[model samples]
Target chain A: MTNDASPNTQPTYYQEVERKGYSRRDFIGFVTMMTAFMGLEKSAIGQVAKALETKPRIPVIWLHFQECTCCSESFIRSSHPIVADILLDKISLDYSETLMAASGFQAEEAMKNTMTKYKGEYILCVEGSVPTGADGVYCMIGGKTSMQILEEAAAGAKAVIAWGSCASNGCVQSAKPNPTKATPIHKLLKANVPLIKVPGCPPIGEVMAGVIVHLVTFGKIPELDRVGRPKAFYSKRVHDSCYRRPFYDAGLFVETFDDENAKKGYCLYKVGCKGPSTYNACGVMKWNNGTSYPIQSGHPCIGCSEENYWDNGRLYERASAFAGFGIEANADTLGKVALAATGVAVAAHAVATNVRKKKLIFELEKEGKQSEQELKS
Target chain B: MANKYLHIHRLRRVYVWELPVRFYHWLNALVIIALIATGFYIANPLAIQSQHEASGQYTMGWIRYIHFAAAYLFFFNFLFRLYWGFVGNKYANWKQFLPISKKFFKEMWYVFRMDIMMLKGKEHMSIGHNAMAGFIYFLTFIAFLVQCLTGFGLYAPMSTWWLPKLFTWVPAVFGGDILTRQIHHWSMWFFILFAVIHVYLVFYHDYVEGRGEISSMGGGWKFIEEEVFERNHHQTPNPEN
Candidate 1:
């Protein structure tokens, strides 16, 4: 129905997936699922389907640098089996070091062709940080520095998407006294392209899909926060939608991993849940087809989405960074020490005042008696 | 000794602290203490293993409720003091807080030298707050306002109240919640430190000056020598006094 009206060279995402043996029914079901879970209206399913059926696939140049490649793993491990195929078809993914079968010359050639052909039209998806130390030799792919690769790739792109915490804000590599000096994408390359940060240790699989879907469907980046995270996903703290939030409000918390409270599904605040401070869709979107996230499995959020989360220290410490109790001593410890010191000072001062008062009273009595005797004399 | 001193000095009762000032002073003290207790709890709650449902306990909610309620009282009480400074007794005047006057600087220097530097026989005398104390209080007031802006700014996201919503721009102005919470939490310590010093200074002044300085806040009255009263009258003679 669409071949006559559509472009000749490129097949639509629907046609591409259909060629890969997926039924039109599977395509519509995927759209309907995306609409339901991606916080979109029922009408969005039709629009999403129409866009997939009609529009040409978006060209994506996925570049890897200094990362664990967990973002790529998470993206491919999306709950829906069809999402991978749909994603593969819809994104027209030119090159990814980890995902693609092509290697050596063919991989390099494909990336070069996409850069020259698509130029300003393709999306530049960055999955890791770039090490700027020693002329960016810390990370090299096929004898080319990540800095050079990123610059060449980012120089001609419509928008740059930082795929994970590593890409958005250098994960462990950029922690305190970073030897490699791995800097995030936004810092390394300063181009005239819109940048979106999907910042988690590895962002939720569907959220990645949602971002791509938003760009493909809307033809523009989704509404971004001040920090460039998509507002639709990063708008609320994980604690807001958490199941045990009522327990938090009520001050019931799991004292330890093996406690009765933990068994009872109490709030994980005391066990150092960073849910209140962390902004991510993990709670709402969940993981592995909404089966469970970290908190649901009784593990405290490590605040992997936040900048410098690794440097923040200890995922299981109770006090938030706001509480001033993460690294050394929490605020309670500091305040208790200060209060105890204040108490000791007050006690000491009281004793000193009492001693001084006793001396003054004694002298006053002695002077009074002496004055009385003198008056009598 | 009382008779002899009274006969020698012709001691007069000078009504320096007005009822409104005294009321505000004690209320502020009480509220600040309550805020500190609840604030620390809000920052980090005690691990009380109550044998009840989450809905039944409502412990953190109560702690937060007490915090927000006391914060409101502290805010309004501060506002009242600000208003009273404009139109209340001369001693409660905002002009006294500002060290703009040459006399203010002179008193501040004298107090600093005599009290802080432990200078003997420096002869520190003030029927009301000296410029040094007043200046510190002015700074404390500014800090209190910042606490309100930041506390409500953080609350704005959590609360449905229009009052807290008014301060929503504070985080945006200050960058975000991390800094705002730090400022808010740190200000509590400021008040605590101020309280300790304030109480100590009052006791110290009472002991050194041999005056009813401690009772002055409670009774709105201070006993001074007739000469000192006359000198003060000559300086700031309010008809009410």
Candidate 2:
């Protein structure tokens, strides 16, 4: 492998690719695949390929705070072999608490050394949220609060990437009545560095790699949505491109989790699937190398990619209703009100007609009585 | 004929609202009722039944058709009203809408004075619509314009060819489909509140002041002493010689 140890040595990422047993043809193929997955145009593939072949590997520091480390787990199990290897080795992943073999001060020393050596040049990847409620005592690693360590690391970083929903939006940790006051990385960091959020309970692995590749290749962050998510991935709702869209359109929904309707692969929307309102690429990208997403495995999406998936509602209860077109359950309230109003109008008209008829009959009877009285007189 | 002195208790036959204006008022009311009914249904479908039961039910489809058709009718009604504002009779013309002059200021003062005096049970009235009612009527017209614009803007995307481009500024001005839907939903509240207040004012004025305001919209004007009417109009009554 190309030794990136020397600060003066400019060994390109291509050298690392060659050392990893990937031929030129293999490197080109990886670039083509990345372009497709990243939703980049064919014209941009050459730029991506050239960057991979020439740009020096970027230095990255991955921090784990109050998290399950699922982001790391998902990253390593990416579909593309080169994605994991290239990101871990070629990208100079200097410090990760879960992946590093060092213990105690050794691990601490590695983190400090990287920050000092590559000051203002490294990327800071925060995996989870930092609790600030109680002077940041809720979560600690190696005698320092996760909040303290995060601020220290983020102080000299060029950019920050929140890897999961926990780090991006505080996830379950910051849901309603959050006791520990877990704050997202972006909110905790007061720096002017560019922040990119890849939010999901555990963001898709390929998406994680794609963010890094785009950063290295373009020398800038990808175009992001209003919420700082990459528009290329988070722009379309999961319902828009889901495989079970036909079932949703036909209104064939799964009433329960284990029902016959569910077994037939009908829409899980009625069973508390937040897919219709959530925007994520999971349905299209699929996890574990394009094998299957959560919905495909008979589990409705809990909308883990959204801001507060945990506190939004129950995972097993369908949304009451969404504000959109079509009759996707719970939209019949308006229909009922309309029908009731029509009935009331009809009843009102009927009463008015009856009253008019009674008035006419009474007048005729009074006229007859008056005529008889006049004749007798 | 009835006694001339007792004739003051009878109704008069003078045109005020005009046929075109009355037609506009009633048609708008009916269409708004239909729109709100179907709109609430389209917003959230509450009732559900088995496929067999739902199959025989054309309620949703028919409601949607009525709603959309009423929307088109409202559009044309508004168009005609706008045209008539410039070309209709003096009382129904564009001048009736503009309340920015010395005369309006004086009228506003008297209207406020009347409201203050009304606390002591002194009768306060006007031959035409009162200043506040005129202002509200103008506001209702503006509200109608907004409803038509937003409703059509939403409907355009469905047809996709011509109408969408015409009101493309709606989504851009409002933010997106989500925001537009919210505005359209909430706008219904304004119309509903206005309707309630309007009906209440009509009845309150008619019953309490004996103005026959409610019947004015149907058969036109109310009865008043000829001498008082002539004095208000700065005319000398020529008695039969």
Candidate 3:
């Protein structure tokens, strides 16, 4: 918690963060940027900056379960300093298997001490799905089941944040025909806890930081979706504000990944871009600080934000049907409907023609009778 | 003195479907068929197009135009139907459409059992649509409502202010335009499937019972047999029995 930045032989991680020429102004700017990325209104920036500047440091116990650890990788690479340094470092991350210096008993003690000392105060961030089958023997950390560890840590935590799709929705571990019976954090833990889901295969780094900052700043969990994702980040679909949306509207699309259309950056709907169905802010806030997103990088979005994304469909195949706006525009349906309309029109015309023919016959017969009478006279 | 022949009273026909109602029904049917056909093509054009390149090539664009035109008609028909449900006859009323009474469940059960029995060669007759068909009809009507809702929801993002607000719930619940479009597209299949089954069942039942059910929609009458009338013990008999 102390800023021991004396001109010494070794510059600490804190000193490197400051010595990289980040002044109080730069720090505040980062806070403002984070506020926007977190989808907080302009009014909340001041509070966020104040919280970052004043709060000593929230004690964090980052647990890695049956996961790929990509969430941790994504977190450290956050574009902003307040995210990369302050939240990750200044937050007093007491224990993390991948990032922590201590090991074995020393690491275990640090986690246990933090939980006991900062009970009901420290933040608990779970990074993977926990397997509940077979007494949780599927995943073991230091001879203890992840379920036991998770419960023990979550019981004393002030707030619980499921850091990735693995923890949030069980990811591929809980896909169809799942043998391990993997369970998400929300499902494993009792419902009353304030659980925030940051779901993605590897969630956007800034989004991960944003959730943490929002919690630290407002002293409460952010608004979440029905699936428990933070609405601030998950409220909008990637397609809503995608740069390539005009192409989708114009009906221009990339037919294949290797096609010239792909280079042209046309919409990837034809090549199985799930942007139209997936909800996430990747297209707007973007990854690695607006540098590029999946679509921008010439790859279609696989809808990692959605639940059971891995099992939705084949990655290369387009969806059988698009839902919503493009409904009546489907070519086959339109053709059939048009043909049916034509049939109806023809039927109506035929009836009209028959009526006209009957009227004409009656008039002609009357005229023929009148002419006969004239001839007789 | 015994009369050689009895004088019979002629019944006057009453107007059941008004101009607007008939127009709406026929127009909706036309448009729905167009939408479904074009939608299927759009879903997988290559499947049908493989037969003949020249014919299939020209059809897509024309079909799209027809589809959009039908969609507009469908939208208007929906609006009119919404209005008519309140102002139209007792049969067309909103109350008639919603099954809110115990009799509805009883009717539904009877219709379900009758349908099963009929499928197994047991003959049963009803004056109006049998219960299962009635329920399906009601379901199709609701599906149309959903189609309109999801359709407009997707359309709202492209359109201007007030029109979009009407479908605000679409984006609010479904995460905006793209998702709304996906929902709208997928629902067309439901409509298409319903139409195919509906037409088939109408003909199937009519043929099996010799009821002329299909022609009743066009001609508005079917000849009832004296035997059926006597069996039912009704003064007036149902034509399509």
Candidate 4:
């Protein structure tokens, strides 16, 4: 319960930026862009700038368990060099297994120092899911199970951030038949801290930066959607903001990779673009410095940001197929078979009903004729 | 035998279905047909390849609009039908749909034996839907709810409107978007199956029983033989059972 962040004692984010040799103009420009990214009105830019200038940097303990480290790679190698430098410095990131030069006991000591010094004040950013199988033997770091480490680190944190789809929703390892029993951070953490999930295979670098900045800027988690994702970034589906949306509306689509439609940049929906279902900021912000994304490069979105995306369907197939209706059966095939069977059964039933009716009528007519003849005789 | 002595000395026309009931039936049929066509198209859009600019053509957009519009109509129509079930006549009452009574099950078994098993028994007919048909329609209503839920669930993310937003939890329950879409697709097939068998049975019953089975839906009246009417009236004090 120690509040180590006495603003006078520790250097503010502004001072850190200045010490890191970034001009004041750069700091203000970054803050303005961040404010806009957070879906704030223009009036809030000054308020955010003032807060960051005086507020002490929040210490972050970034933990990695069963992950590819793509989230870490994306963060450090953000296309915008200033974002990488300032965000890296602004968080005062105390320990990251991937980025920190220290290893073994030294790295552990750095993490321990931050956890103890800023108890209940530092942010815990989990980059991967914790494998809980075999009492969490599947993923162990520094001779400690991910479950034990996550529980220990999360115990004294003020707030927790599940970094990528892996930490947020159990990305790849927790796909069907997950042997390690990989569980997302939200399910593993027993602490009652606020958890913000930034779910993507590797969420856009700027999005990751935006989430961290929003916390440090506002001193609270940004407004989240039903699934606990930041509403500003995850509110709209990629298809809603895509540049090629007109083509989708027009029913113009690329039939195949080598087709003329592909050259013309028609909508890639028919070729299995999942932009319509996947909620993320890729279409609006783009990737690689807002230059191009997967769709722009003539490839369809695999819905890496969505939960259970790996098991939804084939990466390049439409969402017509599902697991419930047999292994290879899809909507069309199943529907057609069902309709056909009904058609055949109805035809057969009609024939049987007609034959039965005809026999009954004939019998009744014969009986009536015989009765009339007997009465006349 | 009873057949030798059987005589239809009089045929009386009795009003069975009310105008509102007939209206709901026809409207539901049309709406379901439109929804299925538009739903399939949305799932896999036709590659019309408009020669004009994408901005000029709104083929997929118009189709989706029609689908959503029809969906709203379907929803409200269902609600109206549910309201009518409580307040409408005995033939149209919600009680007719539930197989709660022992006599209802007996009648269901008789209908199953005579119609499905093709047993040689006296023609079992009712002024409105038979026990078997009423039960099946009840199940279809459940499917209708599923269709509405999953349909609105998929549309929620695309819509800023509050109504569709309320159904956002549907996808999570079904696991994800693809599965929700799959369930919606499956419900369409159920309607198709129901439609096929329903039409066939209507035609078959019209020919066999000759009680105006097909025309009763359009005219809201059915011609019943006097003897058969008297027997049915005595048997069913509660017409629903």
Candidate 5:
């Protein structure tokens, strides 16, 4: 409902929130809350508050490709609806297929206006991978393939943000034998722009907010890992911060979903919880207003945040032996079989060897007796 | 001293495996078996129950501890063998592991035909490891090194020790802990295969040749025919050089 932010009356984040009926105290609370979510010290809250109150909001163009749109759902459902409202209202979000209410030509024109006005200055946020299979016929929007739209938009963006596992690592669509041949944003576009990957099945809403806050507050992307993920959220594995980690170190695990161990809140490692292998802030950040995550809800993490998770094998299977990569048996079963077969073969060989050696020994004794008798004669 | 049975003349015996080499061989065998067993339990732990507190029963924890301990033993023992190869007798020397000469290549070819192809069993005598066995052991050493790096790589994130921390970069290098773990698990199969073949061949040779092949590894001695011993004695001793 807010008017376009022109160069003259460009309001800061606080000014927009106040105009949207938020008190000054509410604005300060928001800044402090976001700072904590970003794993920053309390003192940084003042810095964030100052940044929001003084700096002009940046322009952002959100693009959707071949995806389920779960990322948008998660983003809008942050712990506080005000957080989502403030972020969207505070920024110059010119175009978003999921958020924009404008239809047809009007929406396209708005996106074109933003690209031309703020060329090489606005942020490009991509939510899914580009399906290059069949000339990317898999994902076409507004009579344009996702690939064409991405290159056109990315060409004038300052930095790109890969929103979720879909755009970051090609999620399920790029799994083995990928019919669509969906490629991730970074690989699909040769923009050579600095990419910040906020990867999760649907990333924690606060985390998405945190990245934006860091960029808006610092004028640069946060520190990233080798795979372009923020270190603050992905520095440690879920296992490291899991409430059941003590149970893991103690070797107590739930055998079955409804078993006694499961009732006792034991570790779900044996049941193929990908907590140990997956790197994400789910354990620390929690989901649904800091209420609970998948593990706490009696369900194992399917490693949705990780790359190629869909093709890694059955969700409930352990990483060590997931479908044995098509070998029906797991690593242990196959190893045991190999050992047993070798043992049987060794036994059979020993029996056959005994028979052959025994016959030769008897023949050698006969020859010795014959030679001795001949010598005596 | 009482009644003597008819006896045939057998050539004198010679020492091949030194005490240290024999010690390392059997120790390596024991450690490998332990590693394989413990490694299996660590990867696929049994569903152990504890009536009391979870801390009371450290079943999987102890299994992992045993695996790490055995892995360290295996690594150090291998290092010792490598050191011995440089200073020990000619048979255990480092040169034997390399195909540095024409004889080594010829011996390898002969073994490929005799053992693998089953074409012929023409005798090609060497007191120490045959060229093929030596080459295989060399490859096994490389596998051992890989196991050490990947194992510690997986352990690095869980431990505070400096040793494992040295390999902390390996998981990232391999893309993830799961892939590194799979590689570590697969290498165990290589050792398993090596052990089965190694034991079977020793038993087979001991039965067919009656040269005390199995006993030699235990007592550091082997028996050869008189003519064969004489020929080897009169021959030059430049095999190692």
Candidate 6:
């Protein structure tokens, strides 16, 4: 690993934020919000502020493989444009297909420069899965397979951040019957670097910023849950903080998308809201600068953040009918049929037992009467 | 008149199920029934519309509360039974449930033939659980463990308690929460099937064998024929037969 910039050579994050015309108050506010989002106590705000003022901008290589580029769209459209701009600039994003202005050989040259310049210091942020099907011909960028590109980029990274569900849990590309054999970064990366998964269809923009800011502030990855998701935003379920949870507690649910209960803002559990099971920051953080989330907009959560949510069941089903029980058999239906069959079996068995018992009793009485008659003779 | 012809003095009373075993039985039966009813309701709650304030109604909350409460009872009750399997009387010993010997399998086959296949075979009698019934109960205990794991695993996110947190690995092993919940719900059905057959056999055996089998669970005593008891009393009691 080689470092091109000395500690004194590069401008710190605070200096860059000031250079970008953000007032000192704006910088502190953004830092405070990010620190809170990372689940740090208010007392640690000064420590984070000091770290950001002293640390140089970390070099980052943002890669795009087989994806819809929605993560980039969401990132650039972050509700607070300054938050997006400062964080993106603070990380010194060297190359991104969707956002970078370079094209053709120039873009490849820039990526190569960062990979060699920073060596083990640069962070590798992958935004999509790597397709390995048919020798990775399904997705090719610049004549190299996604697997080939990912391996090269990850070989020298300090840490890896899987930006969206596609990069984290293989979102829709790796759904059942995945034609491309799309593999998430964790499974495909040969590097043993620390990996963080921010899994959502398109993760909330502020959360993405928060993850980056936490890394810049702490000089390491945030504490992660068992599945490697940052525990701050991925610990609690959407249902745990949902405003409509009272409706669920009261047993009031919207039966359909366009019903009176829907108008009344009832719970969406019946219409297949996976909020109770899915873990994400959508409920508390909301989207688009805390305006509203999908559940708030009267649409059921599709459990986009959870692994294998696509194969769980129909989007509108309350419970998932797992494989091997057959497509038509959910737990309740299977249970009902099994109970019905047990009832029939028990009834038939009872009849047989009674018949056998009566015949045996009759034989015993006949022997008793014959023994009495023989005693009389 | 037929009552006089049948000898009433041919049987001797034997203490079988201990007080703790009977207590565990009835408590377990009650808790399981509560869990199944409330569990199904939680999984598929019927629409209970309220024209009043949402805060005024707590139908689903109460049901969930009852379900979780019963689940705790079910878990601890199962643990108590597991402990009792080691310390309880011979009739309730853990070894009785394990099919460890050739004789155990032979008696299990005899029971299946007479009770299930309805073949006229030599009567299978025991002062305690028959081998076939005991082994099935053993399997049911395993199901109990699964239910506890999955139940707590699903509840872990809502809870910050350490006990439930310990079971977070359960869902991870099963893949995810949806699959974990599916298994938890499926175990409810297994208990349902177990209950139907268990109740049917208790009454069936009591009537056919002329022993107080059903009442034995209630009063902790069973009437064993004197000759059969005497023959087996000298040897280590083979509860299998």
- List model 4 lDDT by residue over A83-169, tens digit each: 777667344678888777789998888888888888888899999999999999998989999999999999989899999999999
lDDT of 1 by residue, A163-191 (tens): 99999989888987899999999887767
Residue lDDT tens for model 3, B93-158: 665555677656665666544443322222334434555565676787778878878876655544
Chain B TM-score against the true chain B, candidate 1: 0.91
Measured against the native two-chain assembly using Cα atoms, what DockQ does each of the candidate structures obtain, in the order listed?
0.32, 0.09, 0.07, 0.50, 0.36, 0.48
The model with the greater DockQ, 1 or 3, is 1
TM-scores, chain B, all models:
0.91, 0.82, 0.70, 0.92, 0.88, 0.93
- Please give, for residues B171-211, the per-residue lDDT of candidate 5 as tens digits: 77776666677778878888897899788989776665557
Superposed Cα deviation of residue B213, candidate 5 (Å): 3.7
lDDT of each: 0.79, 0.72, 0.69, 0.84, 0.80, 0.84
TM-scores for the candidates: 0.84, 0.66, 0.71, 0.92, 0.86, 0.92
TM-score of chain A of 6: 0.91
DockQ rank order: 4, 6, 5, 1, 2, 3
Worst 10 residues of 4 chain A by lDDT: A1-10
- Quote the lDDT for B13 in model 2: 39
Model 6 lDDT per residue over B1-241, tens place: 5555455336788888999999999999999999999888888899776679899999899999999999899999999999999999988889888999888887788788777887876563567888889899999999999999999999887788998888998877765686687788878888999999899889888767767899998899998778777778732334444
Residue A102 in model 4: lDDT: 80
lDDT of 2: 0.72
| Backbone clash tally (model 4) | 0
Candidate 2, residue A268: Cα displacement in angstroms equals: 3.7
The top-ranked prediction according to DockQ is 4
